[model samples]
Target: MPRMLDVSDEVRAEIGDEEAARLLAGESAPGSYDCTSCRTPGDSAQERTSTVLFIGDETAVLAFAHATCLPSQVVQVTEEQLQGAVRAIGGTGAESPQQQYQSPQHPQQQYEAVQQTPQEPQPQAANLVPEQAVLGVTSGLVLLQGELHPALVVEPTAPVARPGSLGSGDDFLPLLIEQGFMPLTELAGVPPVLHGWSVLLAAGQLHAVLQPSPNGGRPVAWWQAHQPLQVTDGWRAAANKHQQVLMFAAPVGSIGRQPREDLLRDALDKAAANGKLVASALPLAGI
Candidate 1:
């Protein structure tokens, strides 16, 4: 039986005409599978489904999702990120009939990344440890306008200075504001989309936050997880439903790692009340 799957041209190009035809002809596609975006059961033969191609440096995984949840498209990812996905995905990810790829399963690590850049340039001795300049990232679902939205809270572990500024005050929120993130007075509604910025999630895990490169070739990682950080299934479901993720950034100590969602929300509210929160919504990338 031919599967009712939607494969975009870009994805088709990457997979080649022969492979694409095989998929369209119901040769290798699955009839029943879990939706990559929402993590719910979806039937490709009964309803419209999207074929999402996640391509890494050396491997590619084709995952299925409801067309309503996600469109058929090609998603670019790093090999490490892809392997991370494969580890989490297990048998849920597929590519072609002749090939089944799996990475050496590794223990899942769950920690968000924080970005720390000095506000001003300073002349210092070379050899600096990268870990000292890090940002702390937290993932939780936020309730807004009667809907729950997946959000990422970012803060530096220490005062963040501009890349080459001489002055030395925390510039985390200010720098984000300059980049088009709007300051939040309250969390009553969703933040506006931050163009050219995206949050990458593969296999329902948080991978990295990407920002537009100043040089304008490809976007660069603003904050990347040391390893793929595991997120709650609720967070992933919310992210897939909304097709975006809200990102809130504050200065150091504004929002710490809260052990629970309620605590996280409370911290966000406190940050807003104290006028220390900035937020924007970025389109969700990958699965």
Candidate 2:
């Protein structure tokens, strides 16, 4: 029996036409599988299913999702993220520094905060940030129009200068705007989805923020964590609920280290009012 699968040209290119044909002929495709986007059971024989290929540095994993939740495409990730996902899927008791940790009592608060300090600088030649500065990421649930949404706030520790430019001036928000991030005066509604950009959450933890590559093959890491940061279960739930993450950016010192969600919102609003914030809704990886 033929399956109701939508194998995209991009996905087919990665998996090859022959393998894609096998999937279309129902020779290798699963009859029933959980949607990678929503984690809900989907029957490919009855519903329009999408083939999502997650390509990593060393390996690749082909996953499935419902057409409505996510389209058929390829999502690039790091080798560590792929390994972590394998562990999560296998229920291995292995523990590492990047292991996912959750505390029931402090469900909303991150277990480890020190690991979030800025260190990793990706694509050094591109000059993402100043040589002395680092990006600081904070996770929280943002309230927009009386509803909660998963959010990641990005701020640099120092001013971000333009690539190959002399003199020190912050081009943080402007650079993001060029990359499709929208400026906001108020949090009226969800920001528009920025294509070619996505959040990396592997093993149920915050991993990295991916951006369109300079040379254009796979999306490169715009902001990568020194170690995977554990987010609140509530934050993860909201991300899965909406299938997107609200990403906001501000210049250095615009939105400082906010200790609480309420504080984070207050800082965000202040940044927006001061014209220091830009945002966009990025779909979770696997789309």
Candidate 3:
């Protein structure tokens, strides 16, 4: 046999039957509870007695401090605020705010009237480029494959021809002219581009290569150009071992009429830091 549970009048007056059941069943805590806002360990009785009512679901709980003690402002809520709150909480089907209030219908209307109307075009960061452009650059890098091998291989077509270009030296300059950028497809199995030339990163730091350029001809090879690679996307993983450097070119007017090597170095360094250098092969030599 179980002993009958005794109910106190004070408890019954403070919280209704449904909430009381919930509190007992561990679904919720009693309304008159200690929180960081309300009860400091050494607070006086006067502070403790300054109770505020937090009502919800037809039940009210006593908080041991005034509404000002809580971090949020205590605005007198209206029908619209109530509706917004309900929507925010996903109605009774989801978790709702633990507290609510009821006021005279006229006062509620007045409160709703005083609520600041939402403004159009909320302030946001201005986008210099569309989201799609950024995404395209990212996707292109994902498609490129191979280790970054750095070697000063002559571009098939170029103003400066490699030794024995007609026969002995590989005529890579013609390939560069035909293709504005390096075709990543050609260097799938080769080492990363860094293997050939020393990369001067934007951060004023130098990443020395495993192999020096043939004659130190503009760090990168002509064959590896026009490929979109982001530094952030792991340059070493995508560069061809035969290629010496990964040149990053700026857009038209980005570096004025002619692109400076110093500017390229600075851009590369920043890209490296931000992890934004996705393309590996761009024509950065001369221009």
Candidate 4:
């Protein structure tokens, strides 16, 4: 039987005509899948489906989404991120240092993990402060130039400090720029895919989302939780299958806490409108 499918040029290029033809023929496609964008159920045989391809540094994965949620496109990712996604999909444990200490068996262990600081006080860099600031992040999908793009809206709860200049007003955007985050003057196209940063989704939940470091060392978690944030199963499935995630950041007061996804989206729009948004798209690697 023929199925309703739409394969984008980017996806077709990645998967080649032969594989794409098989998918369109339903010979190498799943009958039903979770929509990559909205995490809703979609049936390729019954309704229009889009072929979304996730291309990592080392491999590529084909995924399906509803035409309404996300159009067919090729998402670029990194090899490490792809491996982590595979592990998550296969139910293999790839625990982070904090995760290892956050075992449910020991409440004390979890407490310690939360309080744990880096061994030896690391010296402050340019655009860095000695004191750590907790950043609040809200993530949602946004339509840009007629394309659905995953975006994260970030804001620090308090004014960020600069080294030896405590309370000198929020230097958050400058700090981010110093760390390689680019401010968005326009949203003409997706920002250049930033490297060494990713949003971690595992076990049908939103885990730690990361930010790039100044030293070009390991990326640091920008948002982590005492307990992982619960999310729709379809969201986690899409994260694992796509193996790529996009992140956006802004300064203090650029965006605020919203109780619902709709409100969060509005906040993102406001930030973008104010010209206070910085964005990056990275592959899903280990936390």
Candidate 5:
């Protein structure tokens, strides 16, 4: 993993010149500021300073803490790091510390849109049970369809925890969106009506569908997978053609295994030939 380099101006001001220099040099000296809640040692022992590095041209932020701390420590450090920095500098601004990161022009508009949207109603068992029961027993059913004209159709049935009880699977939509698939606009108008069924249409069609378990009694749980196929010359071609692909279709549940390096290399070669880049997700070595 790469250490973060660039920090915000506010962060620099909070730590002052000497402490900031030590952190940038990758030194976590004694007497540095630690997050009060997480209790992880800070970059410098003299002040309570947590390091925040925005990785890869500000694409994402990755914060590091002491090895003994929990993952939640990163979250806690992130929540307060900026604000604490602001307070350290003794600067008073109209906006709260949290608001400093927001792009000024769109903040109000974004807040208003969120307020205007009504909460979606929960899904009922009466509607979801029938679909889940049927799909759970079907074999080789087209859970996801690929190699379509210009888009893919994902037909994942809603996951069912109970025949009629509200389920966590109903709430997986936002996760899918975060993964770069566009939520079907039609489905967004209504809440949980489609259960877990979502259609993501991109330059290629990506489908997330449920797979039935061998056991007959358990309500079907949701799984997401995608297939990339190109449609050209009026013929549907079934070939993998996505850059940043995530596949959960592996026979083994853990997709983070490293023994399949050979297979991954071959796939990367194929993708490169097609003018696409391959990025694989590897599990942390000790983790």
Candidate 6:
């Protein structure tokens, strides 16, 4: 029996026509699988399924998603991220797929949980070790040069120490400046878009910001969520309307933990004036 599967042109090109035809004929396609995007059960024999290709540095994995939840497309991911996904699919991760997808009773809740944290715990701080720098993201619309643009303000919760110089009072901005992030004198113009880096937004919510892999094949999530972060309706509307956002990153001491949105903007202004800010504009791509 034939299945209702969407073998996109890109997927076909990558997997070749013969393999795609085999999948359509049910020789290779799984009867039921979890939606790659939303983590819900999907039946290819009953409803249309989108063939999603995840390409890593040296390997490519094919996954399936419901046509309604996610359109078929090729997603470039770091090898590690792809391996994690493979582990989840193979039920080798700490939590089995059933357990991971079992909670989130509501569809909306499930959608929000799509960007679950990796099975490995983040390195923790001990009594002798300082806490890792955690970047806090605040989203708002900033009026720049008489134009309103959606922007994300990132501030480290604590001072970030340079490698081998812990607690040396070194600011984080200079470290980022050594990278490609540009110092913004003013928000008069949008920052340059960094290649292979993008903000992930889908179904009107922010998921994560991704950076390219060191091996240079694909991008991986730099920051992801156990639970999706909430944003204002206005901010979400802005993201959906413009389909992009500006990301500003600064060192911990640069912003000093703003207490309110107005205060946060003030801190950003100060950082710009002090030449301690780096920024980039990113398009909203799906995770």
Overall lDDT per candidate, in order of appearance: 0.73, 0.71, 0.26, 0.56, 0.25, 0.63
Q: Which pairs clash in model 6?
A: none
Expressed as tens digits, the lDDT of each residue in 83-165 for candidate 5 is: 32222222233232121122132222111000011111222121123225211111111112332211121223443233355
Which segments of candidate 4 are over 4 A away from where they belong? 1-132, 211-219, 237-242, 259-262
Candidate ranking (TM-score, best to worst): 1, 2, 6, 4, 5, 3
Writing each residue's lDDT as its tens digit, candidate 4 over 1-287 gives 56698988766665567656777897767676645444456788999987765444445455566665556765444445444433433233433221112222222321111111112111211122245666665556656677555555667766777777846677777877776677776555667666666665432335466676555654555555434444444444444444565567777777776787677767766787888887766665422
Ranking by lDDT: 1, 2, 6, 4, 3, 5
lDDT of 6 by residue, 1-287 (tens): 78899988876776667667877998777778766544557789999988766565555566676777566777776555555455544433444222111111221211111212223222221111134767777777876677667788877777767767756674667766665678887656778876667776532345567777666666767676433454566675566556578889877677765666678778888888887788988876543
TM-score against native, each model: 0.79, 0.68, 0.17, 0.50, 0.20, 0.59
Better of 4 and 5 by TM-score: 4
Tell me the lDDT of model 6 at 16.
65
Model 1, residue pairs in steric clash: 114-135, 115-135, 118-161, 118-162, 119-161, 119-162, 120-164, 120-165, 121-164, 121-165
Q: Relative to the unseen true structure, what is the Cα RMSD of model 5? A: 19.6
What is the Cα-based lDDT of residue 278 in candidate 1?
A: 95
Q: lDDT per residue, candidate 1, 112-166, as tens digits?
A: 1111111211121111113354677778899999889999888777887777767
RMSD each, Å: 9.8, 11.0, 25.5, 13.1, 19.6, 9.1
Model 3 per-residue lDDT tens digits across residues 96-192: 2253322332222211111011111111111112111110111112122433322221111112233344544322323333324333322233223
Error of 3 at 248 (Å): 11
Q: Is candidate 1 or candidate 4 better by TM-score?
A: 1
